[model samples]
Target chain A: NAGVTQTPKFRILKIGQSMTLQCTQDMNHNYMYWYRQDPGMGLKLIYYSVGAGITDKGEVPNGYNVSRSTTEDFPLRLELAAPSQTSVYFCASSYGHGELFFGEGSRLTVL
Target chain B: AQKVTQAQTEISVVEKEDVTLDCVYETRDTTYYLFWYKQPPSGELVFLIRRNSFDEQNEISGRYSWNFQKSTSSFNFTITASQVVDSAVYFCAPLTGNQFYFGTGTSLTVIP
Candidate 1:
């Protein structure tokens, strides 16, 4: 169904390098979120958007940025990749307060 | 303050054995949603179940079941007769207002 699609399944970046993780959903959900998962630590929300052109920060919003330009797309940008930023990122979309449908995830490694 | 807690870090059970994953969450909001997610070795997240705080009845789906108790602030998941394919990491998450938080996931191993 291509519920939520994320590009760059895996990537490796050097310190100070920048990249964007692309995410798009076809479910027409209004709420979209970006989360990062480390080795053993739980998933931490980086940013979220309730609708187009609206974004908000979550628990660990540092060193990350997100933009919601359309109802079907929400992209997360790593302005300055750091060693601590090596983790897997997930993009999810939900219909209002409904269940969240997550993407396949993008794994990034920063050296 | 930690909103969701999964005390069990890892659990190993043989095939055809029952396993229960514990999840405890604390939230001040009366209206909230609790959910469980499964991440297998494939590195993809699968949504298992979603329960609202007001629903006091337990739910069963095939070999999977959920016990949601508001008095103890816990939402536990149990898998009956677990097979080798059931091995994966389970995460408990709670959504309060517009904020959603996930627990440190419990890794499960089903040995055949």
Candidate 2:
């Protein structure tokens, strides 16, 4: 079964380019989060949504935007790509603040 | 600030050897959830265990075991008779209130 699915497993973008990383969960979880992991580092929260139409910022949310239009979708947007933004992005969802199931991760590189 | 600390950046062990990954955390909330995830070369984060704050009991499943000691603010994971397949990155996370904190993850390599 597909738990949390992320699109474009790999992507390369130039500085100032823009793109959106897609995330969808079939478990119907209410809490969805966006996290980025740099080389040899742990995951850092970028944005999160408790449910549709509700979003909140996390520790590092400077260059990222997220929208939760539906229960299954929580997409993260990078309006202006930068070299510092190159990292592996992960989409995760949980039920009732429980264990989280993460996507396979989207590896993005900014030149 | 609530933070999860994994002091070990990397560890290498031969096959059939036992290994333990350390995780320390700080949280002000009365209730929280601690978890361990295994990320293999496939780059997928696989959930290994989840322990509640009130439950300080240790849990074991097959070759994996978790030690949750709330008194010490530590939730460590141990692997018995590790195999080559166990080589990967291990992450410890603690969820307090609306935020979940992750450590710098320990990379374990099992050489066969």
Candidate 3:
């Protein structure tokens, strides 16, 4: 089913630069989430979408934006990237509120 | 608000030895879900097991077992005859509705 897929597995951006982390799932899940994990720390949700055109902020949503235009795509945008935004980002999807299926993760470094 | 705590930062054990990772969570909702996920060095989170708050019955899956205790607000995972392949960071998470909260995680190293 390809499950969940994320593009740009690794990226490095300069301060003030902008980019989008792309995520897509073929499972047709109703829920999609974006999370960031610092070194040796737990994951903190950045944003989530219940369905197309419906989005909400999570624990940490600063410096980032998200949009769910369709059931298969949920993209996270980083505007004016900062050093604080350097972390491993993960995209996950699930049916309802059950167990989540996560992607391999995208490692970002902002200098 | 829901919070999860993993008191052990790191644990080390020899191969073939048993190890247990402890997790404690706090939530006001009577019906919730608890989960255990494993993240290997590759940085992919894999779902291991899940238990609902109402179901306190412990479950054993091959060499892996989980104990969920409602009274103590604890959900513990045990690995019997552990192997070097089991070395990874384990995270405990509690979910309420569509939101999920994760613990700090416990890193386990099984020395071969």
Each prediction's whole-model lDDT (CA):
0.94, 0.93, 0.95
Task: List iRMS (one decimal) for every candidate.
Answer: 0.9, 0.8, 0.7
The residue ranges of model 1 lying beyond 4 angstroms of the native Cα positions read: none
Please give the lDDT score at residue B73 for candidate 3: 93
Candidate topping DockQ: 2
Model 3, residue A42: distance off in Å is 0.8
Ranking by DockQ: 2, 3, 1
For model 2, residues A1-111, the per-residue Cα lDDT tens digits are 799999989999999999999999999899999999998899999999999999999999999999999999999999899999999999999988788989989999999
lDDT of 1 by residue, B39-88 (tens): 99898889999998999899899999999999999999999999999999
Q: Can you give the lDDT of residue A19 in candidate 3?
A: 100
How many angstroms is the interface RMSD of candidate 1? 0.9
TM-score of chain A, all candidates? 0.98, 0.98, 0.99
Candidate 3 chain B lDDT trough over 10 residues, lowest sum: B93-102
Compose the digit string of candidate 2's lDDT tens values, residues B11-83. 9999999999999999988899998998998788999888999988788999999898888999999999999
Tens digits of per-residue lDDT for model 3, B16-60: 999999999998888999999999887899999999999899989
Q: Residue A29 deviation, candidate 2, in Å?
A: 0.5
